[model samples]
Target: MSTYRLFDRRFIRHLAVLVSATVLCFSAAAQNVLRVATEGTYPPWSFKDAQGQLQGWDVDIANAICEKLKMKCEIAAQDWDGIIPGLLAQKYDAIVASMAITEERKKRVDFTNKYKSTISRFVAHKGTSPDVSPGALKGKTIGVQRGSIQAGYLTANYKDSDVKFYDTPQAAELDLVAGRVDYILGNMVTYYVGFMKRPEAKDFEFIGPNLQGGLLGDGNGIAVRKNSPELLAKLNGALAAIMADGTYDRITAKYFPFKLM
Candidate 1:
């Protein structure tokens, strides 16, 4: 072969090796990217704005955790019903949605330490002054989001009541406003952010004592796949760090008037 042709061939081989090394580097970097899923319909915790961008307490917290862990992060919006299944399918590395840490869910995915506690309450139209006890609420209509702890609680405790399950909290709240349901049970933070603060919801008031402990699960937690112990631990550590360093508090204060921890 001509000397010039031999030089060109050697240069091409060097370029090919360089391109292969670059591709491998990129693949390794991509592996470090953590994709987190959140139900962007649950406000105060997760929700989308008019512009269709996700923004809420959970979104901020997730970003903070990613910052602390020094990991490349991407947040994906998923419907509430598909969040868990999507996680199991490896569509995302973690679920930062305000998913309660319950025994039933634990069977499907491991959860990190409780990040925030949740309280459920019964909201009803003002002047009704309806009693909140199971016996008192019997024969009355109650709205709750389907597949939620609140739904499970009502189903288990208020079998006599006419319980209506909705796909989203907004739907339940709408039914309550329309007089289709006498009351609705949901997270206090969500109620306040999504409904209570609105002019239309001014007529609705929390009529019952706050519900917690049993059936509500311990608290809200980050859910990871069953086999991701290391990822879980790292997230837990990042959460603790954010809480200790006051990053968590700062984020919470922006969306909530009180501490969630």
Candidate 2:
């Protein structure tokens, strides 16, 4: 072959190898990064502070998992209703939004083993206890966050009652304070810490039996898209590691007095 042609061929081969190496590097970097989504309005679990930084138990859990896996993570705030859709749409790689492991949810997405077991209950103005049973709930107005497990439970069981659906938990709380709703059903910790702990909630107290089992779900779990077994396995392993090393408990203590996991 002519020397000119030989030189050109070698140059082309070198360029191809360089391009391939660059692409491989980018893929590896992407694999090392974990993108997480949380409902920023949900306090003590995940919420944005005054400076808009994400904080709370769910945020801590996500950070710990990322640390144990040696993966850098980017957490973004999302609406509670959009969290699952965002994960499936690749807006984020996983959800650490205090979502429960319910059978209905299982059909849409796979979940890491539960990180926290939560109980649901009713909260109302103190001194006026209301029965939460289906029969007692008839003609009452119950406020709940839309697309939450408590919302689903109210829909399924309390058809006789007026269900006030709010896009955010804070909205439902505001209505409860205004006495627009008879009562609100949700996570006990969220009510006590996120809402009722405030001075405005001094008159409100938890009432009715602690709701769990059946439709309430197993517990809160990190959600990832279905068929992501490798990523799922990595997260679950990291979760187990954090719990064993006391990282999980320490984070919990900062936000909650008792163990959630």
Candidate 3:
């Protein structure tokens, strides 16, 4: 071969190798691996099944978002109180635990547009007809999930009532069933699915008006660190895609009879 031709061929081979390596590097970087946090105790939203596997609306939604983004996702079970702190400390890339978009949380972490809207309600024994007004509920013990919007609402509006908080809604429901509380304040969907639908809850019914707005904020959204604008954008895009593609509705139908979005 001519000397010039031999050098040109060798240069082409080197360039091809470098280009392949660069493409592989970019591919690896593009494969986003995200660790998502959730309160595995919240049923219909996120919870553990009989086999100890994580499953629920929130888990399904997170998986769907990952699928839409063509990325790898890991769901990490974290305590509700620590979920936000964990995200702030880089323990998780995002939170999809049905966390409401409240002003207090906005001060700490940025939130994507709400994936689901929610409202709180008061539940009491059937035919009891307990007054729901702040004055009427005075000195009455109310059960609510700690750190939830119901707790905040009760604290802010029902000052005369004694509010007892539990780590999980199940515990508060237990208290209500045991007659330890006059009423249980919680999400309407949760009350309907987790309590009112159960055989044990047949004697109970929802009372008062649906409580929302103000301290409850707008709705439930995925939480991301304030500094992760790119991640936030990606999540928002994925959420929109799922909602538009009917995936969101399918998942909602699996857990709820009524629309939450």
Candidate maximizing TM-score: 2
Give the Cα error of residue 228 in candidate 1, in Å: 1.0
TM-score of each: 0.88, 0.92, 0.87
Off by over 4 Å in 3: 1-31
The lDDT per prediction is 0.91, 0.90, 0.90
Which lDDT tens digits does candidate 3 get at residues 116-142? 998888999887665699988999999
Candidate 1 per-residue C-alpha lDDT over 108-147 given as tens digits, one digit per residue, 9 for 90 to 100 = 9999999999988999988766569999988999999988
- For each of the candidates, the C-alpha root-mean-square deviation to the true structure, in angstroms, is 4.2, 2.4, 6.5
TM-score of 2: 0.92
Model 2, 214: alpha-carbon shift in Å?
1.8
Q: What is the lDDT of residue 248 in candidate 2?
A: 93
For model 1, what is the alpha-carbon lDDT of residue 203?
Answer: 86
Per-residue C-alpha lDDT of model 2 across residues 41-128, encoded as one tens digit per residue = 8887888889989988888889999999999989999988888988899999999988989999999999999888979989888976
Off by over 4 Å in 1: 1-27
TM-score: model 3 vs. ground truth:
0.87
